[model samples]
Target: MTVQPTEPTTPRLEWFKSSYSTGNGGECVEVAAAPTHVHIRDSKWPSGPMLTLGPGAWASFVGLIAD
Candidate 1:
């Protein structure tokens, strides 16, 4: 996984929060994905730095963390 900075020319991505997230403010993250990359950011900051990963990396991460 890599940290990616949002560029001025970066296209708008469809970001979604975790289903486990309640409506109330809490520690959470949002994700957006493209065919080649996955993006993750703090739910509280849309314009903040993002963690970008290749599809394989994302899958590996999910596998490691998922129950």
Candidate 2:
């Protein structure tokens, strides 16, 4: 996976951690659902950089993982 630059100047966003995430915070990823795109970030660092993906791409990725 490629790491992108963190846009620290962006506005605040409400992040939702996956149900699969552990309370101890191991390999946790949070997703912020938006109208146009999906914003993903590490639950351990809410202020960190986010990877934005298109809705269709995100749905396909999730479907593959679900299977």
Candidate 3:
């Protein structure tokens, strides 16, 4: 699987937070989408480590969480 690299050499993305996110900032994540991959990072640390997933994997993850 290929991932959209967002290293220091790559441009940053406009990430969207989940609707479930609250001002309490307890546990929240942000996501950004590209043509072939989806990028996910911690909302509390936008510049921190990230997890990249392929389109199909992303779909399955979302489906599992939605169930």
TM-score of 2: 0.75
Per residue, candidate 1 scores C-alpha lDDT tens digits across 1-67 of 9989877876778999988889889858899997789999999988889999999999999999895
Pairs clashing within candidate 3 = none
lDDT against the true structure, each candidate: 0.90, 0.86, 0.88
lDDT of 2 by residue, 1-67 (tens): 9999887885666779898887874857999887788999988887788899999999999999999
lDDT of 2 at 22: 76
lDDT of 3 by residue, 1-67 (tens): 9988665965558899988887786757899998778999999898799999999999999999999
Q: Cα miss at 31, model 3 (Å)?
A: 0.3
Show pairs that collide, candidate 1: none
Query: For model 1, what is the alpha-carbon lDDT of residue 10?
Result: 63
Show where candidate 3 strays beyond 4 Å. Answer: 1-11
Query: How does candidate 2 score on lDDT?
Result: 0.86
Alpha-carbon shift of residue 22 in model 2 (angstroms): 1.6
Best-matching candidate per lDDT = 1
